[model samples]
Target chain A: MRTTKVLIVDDEVEFASTLSERLSLRKYDAKAVYCAEDAFAIARSNPPDVVLLDLKIPGMEGTEIGKIIKQFNPAIQIILLTGESENKIISENLGKDISDYIVKPVEIGELTKKIDNAMKEKEKLDHSKGQP
Target chain B: MRIWKKLMVGFGVYVTLAAIIGIFAYVELRTITKRFTVVEVADDITNIILEVRRFEKNFLLYKDDDTFQEIKKYLAVLTDDTDKIRKEIIKEVGTDNYEMMKNAIAEYDFQINILSKNFKLQKEFISKIGVLTRSIEKNLSGDVLNSFLIVRKYEKNLMIYRDKDIYATLINTLNSPKFATAEVNRYRSLINGLFKLYREEQSSIEKIRSKARNIQTFTEDLSKRERANITTILSRSAILLLFAVLTIIILGTAVNIKIANSIATPLKQLEGITKKIATADFSKRIDVRGKDELASLGTAFNQMQDQLQNTMRFLELANEKLRESRAQLVETEKLATLGRFSAGVAHEINNPLAIINEKAGLMKDYIDMSEDFPNKEKFNVMLNAIFDSVRRCSSITHRILGFARKTDITPEAINLNSLVNEVLKFLEKEILYKSIRLELELSEALPVIKSDKIQLQQVFLNIIKNAADAVEEGGLIRISTGIKNNTTFQVSVEDNGYGIPKEMLKNIFEPFFTTKEKGKGTGLGLSISYGIIKKLGGNILVKSEQNKGTTFTVEIPV
Candidate 1:
């Protein structure tokens, strides 16, 4: 039996609140936090299945949070949210270890699809590690 | 006109006076010379007769006493006196016309002296015969008759001497041709008639001598009077000539100065001003003091200078303003483009991200439901659902990339009429929802213009979007296009929207110059469209009437 969890981080209270509402309405096991510091505190207690990162946050940058999030929970799938359509730095981070990246004003329909793809990629990697 | 002619006439009067005086002086000179000639001749004849009377008296007193000795003394004295009078007459005759008068006077003097000598001889011989008359007292009348015979014997000799002198004077009259000497010939004829009277005993020799004395006195008075006349005329001529000279000098000098001022002074003043203007010192004004053509010309010159200065200043100010306005327009354009792209960047990334988020959540649910499925194929279906989600994510990425940078550019030949219609159709739903009635008046056969299609489409989309937002439901919008120059064209979009406020009219084309509610419009729509048209060698202009309508017309080159 597999248990899936999702984490969302951003500085915008509205975007985080709205995203949490939508995720819960759609039945995803997700949690939202406003800053990277609070996110680390929650992740140590219960590591998420996947992490959604915003690069333009006020505290620690999304890439910095992403690095820390991965260190604490390497098996977790990570998806970077970039407000810019073509940010090479964000995309480069997603390619190496993150499961995916999405540019904002993210369509609600598109975000859900990206989340599913990332979850499966994470699952495949874990399964391969188990087999080895 | 009258003044100038009057001055000319005044000058002419003075010149005439000078000329008349010159002519008077010339005529007076000839009259003076003529009067002098008559007086001078009368004086000469009078002096000669007086000398002759003295000689005759001396001969009568000295005759019998000295005989030859007395005769010689009388003759010598008479000869000296005659020579002196003859020399005086010759001196008065001068060289011009008196050579003949000189010869006749010389001959007459010699003949009178010879006649006086002959009378002295006869008087001496007759006084000898008077001594013998006492013895013959009975013949005493005979003796007295002898003395009478002696006097009678001298009568022929005296007449002869006077006749010779008269004939000599007549010859001088014919030869000298002087007017006063013609009187001398008349006197000579009178002397001849006196001799004839002495022969007739109607005139004695003494009476003839007295007549001669009167002729001499008359000649002297006439000659003296003529000389006085000549002196008076000469002096008058001198005085008149001197006055004429003085008048000519004074008036001629005045005329010279007047003419010099007329010709020189005005021309010299004009030349001075011309030099100043030539050197670019146009600040000076030529004084037009005279009421003449030259003064009018001076006024014209000053007016020309004033106009030139005004024109130069206007052009300079215009040039400065043009530079300033152009610079401001360019700065405004830069800000406009930046604002449009900035807002566009955010929406571009956000839309794709939203879609990805929703799709992923659906896929996650699918994967989680595998255990509850009745068949084993549910797991397989869940895995396929994951694959579909991945493909959808890729397309989202592509769409975000296209919208973000605004670099999906493709230029093509497109008619603006058709382009405007297409944009209007695409925005129909939004237009209807906003209660704006979209109208079309596309021109047929608008020229094919070359431009970036998708960019042009975006421009039209933004303009229509604003127009739609501005108007209430059912408010009208008109889209139009027109041809120009065979290869250039224009598109115009008009709407009965809440027209741009008067205060904001000037800034309508500026970036972020909008009255739209915050967060709803970035205000880059018109600004970006402006840049688009401008970059494609075209321009955008807006005409808006407050509360009435707004129209945006874009002109593009082919």
Candidate 2:
């Protein structure tokens, strides 16, 4: 079985590192980036199968970065983590091919479930494209 | 009396006085006209007497038939005139002289008739004597002729004499004898007969003249008396006219002044009151008296004054309330600005809280994985405590963010009792720390409603916190939930604490109105809860009394 590659992007260093370690323990290849620039650079160099994006970052908007990452590789699944519970930001990026949106202080289990579902959905799409 | 009635009375008095004066003048003039008749009667008497005298003179001078006829005509006229005058005197001047004048007139008329008869007889005697003298001239001698001449001379003397002395001398001469006894006796008889007739004629003429003179005198005396009466009447009428003019002027002026004073005095008072009212002295009122229009106006003005005073006080109270509300609005504006600022800061707080939560959870997971490392129990306890502390910190931050957040919540079907329990979870620690006994009477069959869950949660949380704050240590707080009606649900939070004063009850829900000390309360809890309930098509109501308990009820549609 191929290990699922995951990228965690957040302005909160401890949150992204801890969450990445937890994902690694759960038998997945996960890495953490602290800023939008690092996230973009790492995503272009090593495009992960799934990306966890923080909606609030210092340099660039999460939606903007998500759009750029999707353009770089349409197969990359982007999920947004936000401190805001506003549905407008989520609905605005519905057509941007984002995987899902989650509010802050969300359960680790719930986030993992979303990430696993997004990877599976991408795999299914890739397999279908590979089919007739 | 009414104004018109007063004016009518005034005019009535004036008209009555004028009528009285007019009646007096008319009566006096009438009396004067009646007295004037005496002068006219006297004038007629004077004219009749003159006619009688002229006719008598003519009769004596001519001894003609025409003269006698004139004398008879004049006598008849004089008699009629005197009789008419006497009747007029009887009617006007009373009967004192009327009877005397009537007798005099009757005697005078009889005497004039006899005088006329005697004059005729004298003419006849003269004719007879002429014949006798011619017979003697033809037959007798010188002595008889002398005797006849003496008789003729006496006869001529008797015819001419009207004076009593002349008449007596003539009569004596006639009686003297100068010839034979028989002849002398015959001549004497003739002369005496003629003489007797002449004396009677003279006496009758004298009586007629004397009576005419008496009539003239009586008429003159009556004229004098009647003239005096007329004069008196005319003068009295003139005086009465003057008196009437003066009386009319005095009475009219006096009555008019009385009426004017009655009207003008009250009117001036009313005008003064009205002026005071116009100058904004609404406290002044008019004194009403009588049943007149001015009195009615005074009553109306007094009512107006009361209304004006009441309206001014009402406006002043309303203005004060408006100013208070305006101040509250300014506080609301300040709260809005504070909400925006807190929202901006909430973002910074969330990132750190999330980091802390994740790191603590990771530490707990790592400890659980290496369960047998040195001091594993203490490490697990420390890790769990850290995780719990992080959870507590996140919860507090999340609540603050929720309060400041302007996020629009999608509506969803929610159970009210469950939402109330969820909000109570935040106050559980405070309830325990304060030693308050909480009672929940949530209805199990309470209907679900479509509303914003976050806002409802905020509303319940605010009400429960307010309830908790109101209770002392070991105080009781009771929360009851039930279906209010067919399509509404209600939640009531009650606390046994020092309740709001009666005077402050109305302002309890106003923004920035709080019983808590400054810096301990932002005063936005109940106000925000009220706003939230209203936004969900609901309302928040409060009931409180001093020294008792307070209850806040929230009603929302199902």
Candidate 3:
């Protein structure tokens, strides 16, 4: 079995780093960045199977970053991470390039489960495309 | 009395005085007329006396029948006139003088009669002597006849002139001895007799003249005295009449002035008060005096002024209330806007709180993994405290966002009693923990109103929860629900707690304004409930006294 690669994007550097380290301890390949530009650079150089994106960022919206990363690699799955529990963001971006969403103060176990699920979903799509 | 009655009374008095003056004038005029009549009678008496005196003088000179008749007629006229005005003459000239004048006129008339009888006897003696003298002349001649003729001529001269010398010559001629006959002697005797008769008649005429003069003097004096009396009476009546007229005028004017002042003084006061009322000053009152119409009008005016003052005060109070409510509405709007802005800020703050929470969780995880770490339990405890603080921060942010979010109302029929009971049910545990007395005075007849039930429950829960929290141990909290008015229903929560200070009362509805100790309150309960009530088309009001209690009332339209 291959380890799942997860990218974490957040304006809060400590939150992103701590969450990434926790995911790394849980046996998932995880990286963390503080801005949309670093997130874009990491996505282009070495893309992850799943991305954890904070909705509010410094320059670009997390949704916009999710769309741009999806364009770069269609197999990469996006999960939105936000401090807001309102359903407006989820309903707006749920079926578009986003796999799922979670509110912040992210639990390490829940995040890993979501990342594993996104990787599986990407593998399912890639398998179907390879066969076709 | 009424004003008109007073004027009528004054008029009545004036009429009475005028009548008195008229009567006085009439009596004075009558007295003056009587005096004039007396004076006329006096004048007539004086004229009659003068006419009698003129006739007496004519009779004395001529000794003729016509003159005697004129004197008698004038004396009768004087006697009649004196009798007609007898009382007036007596009043003026005394009774004794009037009677004396009457006697003098009688004496003059008697003497005229005696003189006329003596004149008749002389006429008879003259005729007899003429016959006797002619016989003697025929019987004698020469010297005797010449003497006889001379005697006759002397007799004729004596009769015509009535002189003493002629009488002496006749007597000498008749006494001559040339005719020594018996008939001649008779003629000489007749001449002596005629002389005696003429002497008596002269004495009577003198007595009549003195009497006529006395009567004339008496009548003239009487006339003068009566005229003076008439003049005195006229002047006195004029003075009395003038006094009467002046008294009437002065009295009438005084009465008129008194009545006019009685009426005009109140009217003047009314005018002054009316002017003050026009200026919108209603502080002054009318001093009502009499029971007259003007006094009653003043009383009514005072009542009107009182009403006006009360109405003005009421309007001022209403205006002040309107201004305060308008300012409150503006504050609510500002708070709403602030609430929206704070929601965004709350969301922004949540990000950092999430970071801090994650970091604390990470530290705790590392400490748990390190079995031999120094003071690892203390480190875990500190991290747990940070985690708790983060949890508190997140809860506050969530509440801020809830307050700013647009609420979707699910309108349904709600019983206010049941709603209050439900809120109290939520606060029951806190109430039991504090040993606070919970009193419910819910009205059974409360009508079911159409409102958002969840929002109303949140509002009631917040208010009643505050009441429970505010009270001391075993203190009282009372929840009551009732219909406030025709269009709204009310629910009130009262607690005997340390009430909010007066200075802090205005800011109680502001977000994050709390009197509770740090960490004991998030301060968003009442503000969020206020926003909910406002959104539900209702009002929340609070009343508090320091150290006494606080009561919060929520009024929602039916």
Candidate 4:
């Protein structure tokens, strides 16, 4: 099986670090950053297979970051992770090529399941794009 | 009835009294004037006395039959005048003086009659002497007869003159020696008889004059007394008039004051009550005690005051209720703000908890895959505890998000039983852990209702969760669903637990009204559910009895 490249963007350093480490142990290539700028930088250099984004970031809004990510790489799957269920932000980004959303304090098992679903949906989209 | 009429009536009473007094005074004045008329009769008596004296003098001078008849008429007139005066005096001054005057007039009349008879005798004597002298004339010498004629002339003069000196001169002449003794003796005899009669007649005339004077004096005194009596009467009448006027004034004033007080006292009381009402003290009432207009007004005023007081009390109660409702609204607003705020905070906390949960899972995996690991079981248990707490926290944050999410309804055709089942699935574990028996009595072939699925799900979830919380171990919660006349779906959640107190049941759905302990309840569950159900055009009802159980019934249109 090919390793999944996962990108994490959050302003909370410990949360970003711990989440990235947990994802890496789960046998995926996960990288974490604390701001939207770094997230964009990492995404443009080495495009991720799936992106995990926090609804609240330091400088830029979560929905704007999401738009930027999809614009940069349309094939990259994005999943939203939020400390609070800011329904406005979640629903706004849901239309912007977001694959799924999960309220925070999510169990690892559940997060893994969502990640697998997101990767599958991305592959299907890629296949369809390649056919046309 | 009206204040003006009352006062006018009071004044009218005084005017009537004054008119009465005026009439009495007029009558008294007339009586005094009438008595004065009787006093004027005194003037008639004095005039009669003067006329009687004048006629007497005329009779003495003329010595004719006409004079004599006129003198008699004068005397009768004098007597009549005296009698009239006496009668007047008796009428006015009582009978005591009338009798005295009557005696005086009678004596005067007697004296006048005597005087008249004596005059006649004297006349006869004079005529007889004349005849005797003529018979003796032829028997005397010429010179003696002449002397005799001279003496006779003197005697006639003396008789007419009625003078004593003249009579004496005539006697002396007749007694002279120059005359014959027989001739003198004859004349002297005749003279002696005439002298005696003349003296008696003179005395009687004097007596008549004296009696007339006495009557005149008495009449004058009687007239004076009558004048005095009239004066006395006039003064007394004036005094009585003054007294009557004074009595009328005093009595009128007293009555006027009484009438004014009767009217004014009630008016002042009404004014006082009005002032109290103006100041917002509506309890004061007029205490009038009689059945006049003022009393009736007081009764009406008291009725008005009672109504005003009742209205004021109603207003106060309404204001109190309004304030309580306003307080409730403020609490609802605070809860809304807190719901949003806590949702945000919960989301923020969820991120870190997720991180911890993931890290702990990663550690557990690492320990399980490693060849040699120290304290593996202890690490596994600790990591499991971390996972467990994180999962618990996630449940709480998710539930908070459930309520905080915008409740804008998205309607869909949904089966009521399926919806209720979906909501109960969330609380299945809690029910098992508490050992509570759950029963579902969902009716078969229930039609799908058109409503918001997520909102109804939340409503059912809240009610079922409250039921779970209310029950003890082995308690039963029965959830039933039904189709009501093919138009609506109804769901009832009943729990056999310690029931809600009757007093608090009414307020249970009000914001922040809670029965649970602090930290166990935000008290927003039922309140939010009620609001959502209401917004969805549904109804929720509750029935509970103390120490028995509670039932919440929800109905939504199909």
Tens-place lDDT per residue, model 1, B1-558, is 233553565577576877688678767965665454444435434554555556555645553333434434543553444344444334555443244433334444454444455554444433533443223333335644464344334433554464555444444533443323433344334434444433433233444355444445444554675576678778878887888888777876677567556546666877887787778666777776666555676788778877866876788799887886676567555544554565466454454445455455445555565466565466556655654553454443443344335533457887776777788789868876877766788877665666788768878888888888888778988888886676557778899988998889888766557778754665566766776666565778889998898998887776
Please state the interface RMSD for every predicted structure, separated by commas: 5.7, 1.8, 1.6, 2.6
Rank order (by DockQ, best first) = 2, 4, 3, 1
Q: Could you give candidate 3's per-residue lDDT for residues B1-558 as a string of tens digits? A: 798899898898789988987887788778768767766766776787677667666766666788778877877877887788788777777888878888887888798788778877887888887788778778878877777777778888887787889998776666656666798778778878888788887888788778877876776777677678778877887887788788878988898888899899889988998999899888678889999999899989989899899999999999997986777677667767877798789887988888887777777777777777678778878887887788678778877776676445679998888887877788777888999987888888887898888778878888888888888999998888888667778888899999999999999988788999987778889988888887676789999998899999998878
Would you list the clashing residue pairs of candidate 2?
A: none
C-alpha displacement of B89 in model 4, angstroms?
13
Across B1-558, the per-residue lDDT of candidate 2 in tens digits comes to 789988998998799988998888788877777666657767767676677678767766666668677766766675676566565577665786777777777787687667767778877877876776676556666875676566566556655664456556655654555444554555556666787887787678788778878877877777787787788878878887898899889988899899888888888988887888788777556778888887887788788888888998899999987986676566555555666676667667777878777777787777777748888898778876766665555554554455556434469999888898899899889999999998999888876788898888878888888878887899999999998658778999999988888898887766668888754565666766765665565778889876578899998877
Residue ranges of candidate 1 with Cα displaced over 4 Å: A1-7, A20-31, A36-55, A59-106, A113-132, B1-558
Candidate 3 per-residue lDDT over residues A3-98, each given as its tens digit: 888999987778889888877777889999998889889999999889999887878888899999998888889999976566566778898888
TM-score of chain B of each: 0.43, 0.56, 0.61, 0.55
Residue pairs with backbone overlap in model 4: A83-B347, A83-B348, A84-B347, A84-B348, A105-B350
- Model 4 lDDT per residue over B190-248, tens place: 78778877888778778778877877787677668777877887788788778878877
Top-down lDDT ranking? 3, 4, 2, 1
- Whole-model lDDT values for every prediction: 0.63, 0.77, 0.82, 0.78
Best model per TM-score: 2
What does the i-RMS of model 4 come to? Answer: 2.6
Candidate 4 residue B542 Cα shift, in angstroms, is 14
